[model samples]
Target: NCGTWFLGRLQTERDVARVLDGLEGAASAAGNALDRSEIGTLLAGLRSRVFLMNNAHEEGHLLFHTRWAMSYLRGPLTRKQIKLLSPSAPEASGDAPKPAKSAVPTSKSSRPVVPAGIEEVFFSSEPGTYRPYLAADVTLHYLRASHGLDSWEKHVILAPLEEEAPWASAELLDRGDVDFSDDAPGVAEFVAPPAGSVGTARFRSYGKQIRTHLYQARPMSLWRCKSLKLQSKPGESKSEFASRVQLAAREERDAGVEKLRARFAKRIQSMEERRRRAEARVDREKSQYEQQKLQTGISMGATVLGAIFGRGGFGRATTAARGAGRVAREREDVQRAEEELRDIEEAIQALEIEVEEEARAYLAEREDKAAELEEVVVRPRKSDIAVMGLKLAWKPD
Candidate 1:
């Protein structure tokens, strides 16, 4: 099952493997994809919740967690490692896989060479990629027939430890077997928002590997912000000139985003108002007619020409006509309003997409412009050590 908070008693080995492998795989594949700032905010809230749970208990295991809870901890390093012993030379650009054998060193080079055993790991600094190691989480709960109503022990692991770390190295803050009990519920629950948000969240279930719904960012490049300055005024110091350029770039980007938002704000508001009014009109019409028709339909008609038999055929006919008219009009008005609302909604969505695309384009253009303003001089004025040292000082005695 899905979206369940209680992942009841799990006894199968398959369940344990599913939760661990699924989360690791997700973390590896989603390298550098999630929004770090937003994720940090959410994780902070999760920590707070965990803190409350831990405080509820007096001792034993301070954390509220099951045995399989370890899967929620540190994630495997998804980044490619630079091996000290490879048969082939390392590639200059992207990270390359290690060769079967170490390559022969043809010459002494400037790059530092690592000695025999230790390997250099190129860890990515990007958040949500390989950043926090632990890719996703699964909440598990166990219960038995002896338990009373709502008195079952609930387990939630706040964080995970390194997979192969020494048992004595750290205080293991988790408990319970992967599948704690045979009578546990076989489902998990999670919140999955729609696509076109700032960042996407991916998660896997402990019972079975569930392909989680991902929320895609709207593709706005507003986050890639910087100040860019091209030229300096006469007699300005190099640092001052760079600062001025940066300030200008920032102001330009801010103004551009604000302008684009303003342009679409009125249109979006008008469309929403129109949709609301259309729906309200349909509701008003239905209320005035449907209620009366429903009341008449449920009652016995008054006696007419067939009064002796206690049957009023004319009254029945009149009631039928009124009821049918109400149904027909209600259907027509509702259908029309629904159609209008759909159109408005579609229009609003289109505009939103356009805004996101436009924002991305504008930011990209600004970034390119900013890049042109930068000039990095990595080479020194002099190659000799002494001359390089001379250039660093205030220059005169």
Candidate 2:
């Protein structure tokens, strides 16, 4: 019973270890000893049932596992069971299988062929929520079609669930055409009927197994799908392309910064020129003020001498007052020019700071976008068949 429970629920090697620990702890509490060899055998059996594969993508690499259906281990279903589960199987009272009412012909002929190539397929439902049984022939045809003349081997790369990383691995199904047939070692079938009344009616009338396969076990929340090519072009491997993508993103970020700086360059230059003019005006005003002071001193000294000697006294005194007024006016002009220069300098400094901040923001945005970009290669043709429980819909990147 424990073995059966473990087989049904344990999804990872860590889960298996935890189960073993619990079993050992229970045995100790019951005053019984657990054998190491027995534990080893159990682990070996679990390994056979679970498939662990590496997830190689832009995201960090991780190991995740998915268990084969329990039926795979139990052995092939009896002929009677097979007949009952088969889409074309006779009804319970030995009545012939009902013919589909649609004009579309047989299901096999109607099903679309799997496209040839490495396609990044996506699912609308969350992982592990639904597992549908697809026809083995369609999957085999896809593998054969995708395989090259020189390289006839292919594998179905299963990405880890969004929440299954770091602590676990991804799943890999060997796509060898011969090993996935109806009678193959790890393939099995189970009866799964459509859920709602409308779906059931459609399935029965149209013999639409594909729709039933997907909608029967779909989740409440719907998700969008995206496709990315593993290789951008011929002669490029996935890793190489990924590296190139990173390089391209970096280049793009730098170019954006440069563009932004170029945009602000003229304005900054113009402000600096205005500031220089302000400074030059301030200098000219200071020079005029100094000359005015000198003239005022000479006029005052002459006025003082004329007053003491009583020679041209009234005229000299009037000229001294005029010189002093001129000096005061020059001083006020100097102060105004200095204030204008200070204001211009401050404005230029503020503009430079704003440009730096804007450039930093642009760089950050580019980095965030780059992090989300994935390297993908080919777009496989969309098909109705859901190979290994995943109906892959390809969307262009």
Off by over 4 Å in 2: 1-231, 234-239, 375-397
Local distance difference test, each candidate: 0.38, 0.47
Q: How close is candidate 1 to the true structure, as a TM-score?
A: 0.33
Q: What stretches of model 1 exceed 4 Å from their correct place?
A: 1-230, 234-240, 295-311, 374-397
Q: In candidate 2, what are the lDDT values of residues 1-397, reduced to their tens digit?
A: 2322233224444655676676666555555565533343334332233421211112111122454555545577899987777768444766757775322211211212222221223222222222222221222111112212111223353322222121133233465522322221122221121111112122233224333422332212111112222224344455565577678777777888899989999999999999889999999999999999999999999999999999998999999999999999999999999999999989988999999999889888766655554432222222433344232222111
Which tens-of-lDDT digit does each residue in 27-86 have in candidate 1?
A: 445441323232222222222113111111121112122332344535554344333324
Question: Candidate 2: how large is its RMSD?
Answer: 24.3
**Deviation from native of the Cα of residue 237 in model 1, angstroms:** 4.8
Q: Candidate 1 lDDT (Cα, whole model)?
A: 0.38
Per-candidate clash tally: 21, 11
